[model samples]
Target: MYYTLHQLQIFLKISELQSITRASEELHLTQPAVSIQLKNFQDQFPIPLTEVVGRQLFITDFGKEIARAAEKIINQVEEINYKTMAYQGNLSGRLKISVVSTGKYVMPYFMADFMTENKGVDLIMDVTNKSKVVRSLELNEVDFALVSVLPEKLKVDTVELMPNKLFYVSNYDRKFPKAVSKKYLFEKIPLIYREPGSATRNAMESFIEKNNYSVHKKIELTSNEAVKQAVISGLGCSIMPLIGNKNALKNNELKIIPVRGLPITTTWNLIWLKSKNLSPVAVAFLNYLKDRKEGIIQKKFSWIEDFINV
Candidate 1:
């Protein structure tokens, strides 16, 4: 027979007070009624639960065993209540995020700040390239991904967080033809670029194709930093994020190629599986992003345009 919650509670109250009169008084039941419920439970099992001592009632061995186990249950129940209260009062849980290599530079700041307010929460991240991140999300390997591009057929949804303006840059000494033109962008200078499937590479190609231009040669540099280094060495010019090149620009180690119709702008965006429901931690982090000043993605990144203009 399935025991009811009411039966379990009655059993626990009797175990605590250890007397039918006391338990009955506390539970507002007649003593005989309390005795009947307890006796019914005991009879369902093998326990008799009663032993008559001289002028007193005492519990039998099996009854004491059940009582101790019930006490443990009661302790655990109390602990659960306390934890529930705490959880409702503040955000608490683990947040596992996957980010594109570039997002590793910015996304973590929000994660860090969110964890500070909700100190008990855990933040874990898988940092990978754009392709691997999408793969991981499709396989349900991460809570969400921070990405620059979202593929059309990928089982994912995206929020355009901020515009990631792609610009052409070259070493201070790598002088190009008269005041950057379409042919100069496409044909004259070699491109220090990312891997073939990179969003930056795709966007750059789209711009090139749309403008009716073609690159004579490109020197594929796999990383933004590496591309920056290559451009700094006068190897070639490259398209990269304004944030990525801000410091280099400030130091005059590089200069944005003065190309008209340059900076192929795309969103440095957030992506997630459209079918996956976000867990509490992930939702709270996203809401937290919408709450704070630096937490808000697009508005906080105004310095991007400033970096380009400066």
Candidate 2:
């Protein structure tokens, strides 16, 4: 059997998108060209790679197995290219990181300088919830994971980055006393909550449980942005990370309520499993963070200290 790397690439893209048209669009090729290549690729194997049902394309089980192998091959090829660049005295490789949703606001600032200095490095950052982020780290799918809360069961080493403060905030239009009691806020006002497995949700729950307060559950949202929008729309107040609320708070779209024991504080950390070997790109990034994290926090996030004080 004979197959080219281009064929493997096309098959992988087709499997990922499950639509020839979409794969073509993403690959920057015409639909006819993509279909022709896909047909040629499939001809090299006896088993069917894909099936169409009611005009919707779906990769078959066999296709999925092939796609997985194709991905490994492509990654290896990319690594070979990166190695060549490294030999030429250029830093080049893929850097994959999985971060909790709120970390999206903070991690980019830390990465901006490193990414600028390393032009040949390809950064693949996934912004997701805590459970998925942890899972990615556990499976060694990503070089590192950014989170406010450390996973209890995973034995990992962490580099502390900065403070993550959670605040109880409501729509600016909502009227409240200068200092509302925690009991009143929890018992009377409806509280929007992040979904289970979110670090923010875990923090909020711990605070409420500690204070022996019972909250009125309004609705559950999946992301920090969604929860912020809900609060801004006056749907309900929510306990949110200050990082995700800076813009809304600055614009007076949301207002933080003053209460004792407010602004739950946690440290943002970059974590990796102790057992995994660090790639050159990952080690460079870790070194960058170790050397410059304090400066980045001072420059980009000094405003957070001022906001919390007020």
The models' CA-based lDDT, in order, is 0.73, 0.91
Model 2: lDDT to the true structure: 0.91
Task: Kindly report which residue stretches of model 2 are placed more than 4 angstroms away from their true locations once superposed.
Answer: 1-7, 17-47, 177-179
Clashing pairs in 1: none
The candidate that wins on TM-score is 2
In terms of lDDT, which candidate is strongest?
2
Tell how far residue 272 is off in model 1, in angstroms.
Answer: 1.8
TM-score of every model versus the real structure:
0.66, 0.89
lDDT of 2 at 81: 91
Model 2 Cα shift for residue 298 (angstroms)? 2.3
Off by over 4 Å in 1: 1-90, 293-300, 308-310
- Candidate 2 structure quality by residue, lDDT tens digits, 171-211: 99998767667888988889899999999999999998999
Residue 292, candidate 2: alpha-carbon lDDT:
97
Clashing pairs in 2: none
